[model samples]
Structure formats: C-alpha cells, structure tokens
Target: MEPIKKAYGYVTRTHKGRPQVLVFQHPILEAGIQIPKGTVEEGESPEAAVVREMIEETGLTEWGKPVFIADDRWKADDGSIHHRHFYRLDQKDVPDQWQHAPSGGGEEEGLQFTLFWISSPGDIPLARGHGDYLPDVLEERPEDGLGCLEPSEDVKQVYLIEEGVERIIGETREQISFEEGGTVLVREQTLTSEEIGDRRTVTRLMASTNRPLTVEDSGGGGMRAVYAGDHVIIERDGGEKRVPLHHLPVDTFSVELLLRTLPLEGTYALSFHAFNVLKGEEQLIEIHADEQPDGSFKAKVRFGAMIQWYWVNTETRELLKQSSDPAPGLKMEFRR
Candidate 1:
C-alpha cells in the first residue's frame, strides 16, 4: 500500500490587553478559529512542507524558521494513515503581506478567515487537529502567563435516593429522624357510613416524604406500611408500589443551598403533574397551599392518577395534611 502523507502549520501570537495565544479562522467550517495549518505533498521535507503549507494557506511569506514540535502517526479523511510532523512559527516573523490561496475548485467550497492573538495553550480550541499539540506548546512556554487558560474543574460526588421523607444532602449515607405530636385528617368515602355510607373509602392525611404514604396488606393477614425512607412490613401485605416525591411546584430545584433553606411562606407555589413514563408525556395538576401562624401549611393536590400529597412541617416534624381521591387511584394517611 502507498504511504499517505500530509502537513499543516500553526501560528501563536499575544493579544493586546488579552491573553497571549495564536489564532486562525477556518475558511470552510463555521466558528473555525485556531492555528493555521494544511497538508504537505509527497516527497517534501517535513520542514519545507510546513513552510510551504503555511505560506499557501495564510499568505504569510516570512514564516521564519520552523521549530520542530513533535512527530506522530495520524489517520486522515481518506481512511489512510501517515506519520505527521508538527512545527511552530513565531508570530514576530509573520510577513506583513499574506493572503489565502484561491480555491482551484468552484465557489461551493465556502471558506472564511480571521486572525487572533493567543498566549497560553488552553486558549486554542481543540477542534483544529491541534488539540493534542497545544499542551506541548504551552508547557514549553509557561512564562507566557496566559490568564484564564486552564483545565476545567472536576465533577463533585453526590448521593441521590428516590425513597424517604428526609432530603439526603451530603455525599455520605446518614439517617434522619423526626419527633412526635402532629395533626392528621382522615377522609373516607363509605356507602354505609354517616359521611358517605356501605362502600366506603378512607384517606388519612399526614406528613412524610414528598410522595404519598402507602399501607400494604401482608399475606398472613398482617399489614405493611412504607413512606419515603421508612418501611414497616408485617405478615399482612406482601406487595410494594413506588411513588415519586416532588416539592411544591413553585419552588425551583436548584444547586443553590440558600434557596433550599428559604422559609416556605408567601415564597413559592406548587403544582402536581401526572407523568406517563411509557409515552414521555406530562399533564399538570393544580395544587395550592398556605403557611399557618403555627409554622404549618396546608395544600390540596390532585393528579389524573390516584397519588398522595403530604404536608410535613419541617420544623416540628408533623404531618399537617394527608388525603386521597378515589377518582385518581391515590391513597394516603398521616400519623404523628
């Protein structure tokens, strides 16, 4: 197989009042600004190839002496591979007269050009095939003192749990406990009862996690209950259903810690929505609440599907309101 050969050159310069770096605009690609470079023809010395490529591409005649940067193998667009030689030319020697070569092909090969000054290695965009060589150049000229030219920060670790009443905030696992003494409203629909009598459905209101509280029946005629992170499984119910928890709609979940600690008074609004995971569609349910003088609040929530809404007083660890709607298939209760 015939060996594939190509060459390109890059220029680095310092911008006045800005960082010192090299700049070159790509003629064909949009937002293509980086070091100028092109391929070398066959039988040409690597150094001579870079010189000729730079002159032909940038119109710079006085390209100065080519400084060898590195030599490595690379793959080209034609699927053939070749060894590449890289060199850097000082911007000080750039000739005043330089122009782009006219395209041998017609105008459909759109290309544009621009110039910029660069100081540090990080100032160069990684796209122009110079991404790898940029670091080497910067290391060789650390004294250039390019400001704001550094690698990005690493992502921090975090812990996320879907179940539970407490919002886990730290990176480690920890238990959150709540004390007693709170109010609970139980709503039941019964055909034979006084409120709505024989076939009756009852909803108990309480404070738990952001989702509804569920009571399961154990197989042995016992009962099992789960809310947020708390679970109690007896011999009664052996089934389990997972519910989603979300804060009142008005409060936008953000990375800002202060927003999470803000007092829940006239501060925000809440909305409920039904999410169909299978279809990736959502329908909003209107829910409203107000803070009471005793540091407690109340809200009425409704979703297309039976879902639970709980009002847990963060300060006193109380369940303020728990309710369910038969029409929506939601069941909930509260205990303090």
Candidate 2:
C-alpha cells in the first residue's frame, strides 16, 4: 500500500536560552493538543507542505528556514501506513500564549486554536503523537527540579489588611549562610508572629542542582517536613502524611527568591507544588507572568482560594509591590 504522506512542523524558539517547541489545542476540548501538521497535496513537496501547514495552522509569518529532520512510518487507527515527515522550523515572533483563528479551508476552518510554547514537549497533555521527533532537534528535556536557587540576604515586612486597614503581621527574612559552589544550597527562612510578639518559626528548604528552591526539609508551627525519595514526609500532630512531589514545591517563605531569579517574559505560566504549613498537604499552584511594555512585569499567582499579584522591575527583578487576601475579609500587602 502506498503510504499516505503527512508533514509536521516543530515551530521552535530559544526562550531564555532554552529550546522550546510550539503546540496548540483546539477550543473544542476533545480535539486534543497537537502540533501544526497537514496532509500533502498530490504534487506538493514535504518542505513546501510543511511551510504551508505552519502558516495556515499557526498564522505565523516570520520564521527561519525549516530544516527537514526525518521520515518515519506510523500506523493509524485504521491500520493504514502514515509516512510522516518532520521539520524543525524556528520562529521568534509570537507570544507565550494566544488564540488564533485560522482561515485555512477544511474541517478546521474558522476553528480557534490556543498556541503556546513548552520547554519540554513531553509535558504536553494528551499529545496526539505529534512530538515523537523532538529528540532529533532539541536538547534533552530538563529534569523536573528547581532550575537553580541562589537566595540573597534580604528581609521584608508583611502586613495584614482587613477591608482596607493594614497592620504589621510580622516580617519574613531569607539568607544564605554558606553554599559550597552550587553543589547543595541550604535555604533558611524566618517567620514571626507579631500578635504573640515572642514566638518565631524557622523553615529551611534545600535545592542545589539549580535553585535554592526547597525540595528537602522545612519545619515550624508544630509540623516537620523532610524529603523521602519522591515524596515529602510530614509529621504533624502526632500523625504522619506523605505528599508526592510533582513540580518541586515552593511556599510563601520561598517565593521571593524565585521572583527575583525566574526568567520572566511573554505572559508565560508555570506550575509548582505549593506547601503550606497550615494546609494538610501539597497542592498545585500556578504563576502567570506578563512582561510589560517597559520591560517590567506583573505576576499573578493562584493557590486554592487565594490569589496574589506582584509587580516587579525587570532589570533588577525586584518586587515593587504585592497584594493578596489571605482569608475572607482579610488582605495582605507589601510595597517598596
């Protein structure tokens, strides 16, 4: 049987020196996430077809030459042979995420697509066998760990607000005493209760392969946490619980270090485990960063019912302001 020919485009970019590939999903939830690809016309060459598919599917115009990578045989659900041609097409003129409605005629005509870049293609949710050729093009997907955490000695005051009135809850401090050349970094945080005026809680996290982000140990307020393989074992109130590690966890005590060091651009969204001492276990948290026209940034973070916003100077990556509601009718803010 003559193999049905198809061309796939791996639209790529170097984001913060990290090679990332573009992928999209149809607004229709069941369409599944996928890359730009199309069937070849009778006389259309693979190269030409790939270029046409890319422009039609992604609505991207500015791009470098599409480098052909390989030809593979894939079996379709109907047991038919699919002769797949893959190409690495580099593009720079796009945002981290956007909705594009393609005018290309066919079943998908006028259907909206949501496009975004993924540093690790493997992380694509329900990928439709569209990224099998990544190894021939991009560097190995980075391990799911803190990229590298180097915390500076800094202290900031925290204030609690209700309806609009603000008061000093306490101050949080971060410091790096001694780290032996990026091998292993010990991160320590100090939190105090202003109401008690005499009690303090100290929490320490460890992340050295890349960031001072914690993946190891933290303890305070009648709870102790330590890393045990891929899970964090927590001992609280005479009971033990384990939370599986997804993305390395980060907490309020450690977010300042990350905000100062993270690569902020293009309204990118990132996820991590959020560990709260007050909460029972680790939960997923998301941070969305939007780069402003002046090269500054506004980051929005969501964890459970609480949402936090931060404004930072892009040049220094310093937090200029922050606001969040820690509880019902209660707000917390920080400004510099």
TM-score of each: 0.35, 0.47
Candidate 1: worst 10 consecutive residues by lDDT? 249-258
Model 2: residues with Cα > 4 Å off, grouped in runs: 1-151, 196-220, 246-256, 272-280, 292-294
- Whole-model lDDT per candidate: 0.41, 0.66
Error of 2 at 39 (Å): 60
RMSD of each: 21.6, 17.0
Candidate 2 per-residue lDDT, tens place, 1-336, comes to: 798999999888898988888888877887788889989899999888999998888888776667655454555788886787777898875689988887668898768998988887457663555766554446553342233433556577778888879888777665554333333345555656556343334444333222222232234436665442234556676776766655444555466556756778788788876666456466667889898887888899777666889887756646677888767898877653
Query: How many backbone clashes are present in model 1?
Result: 45
Clash counts for the predictions, in order: 45, 6
Error of 1 at 258 (Å): 50
In the predicted model 2, the residue pairs found to clash are: 147-210, 148-210, 148-211, 149-210, 149-211, 149-212
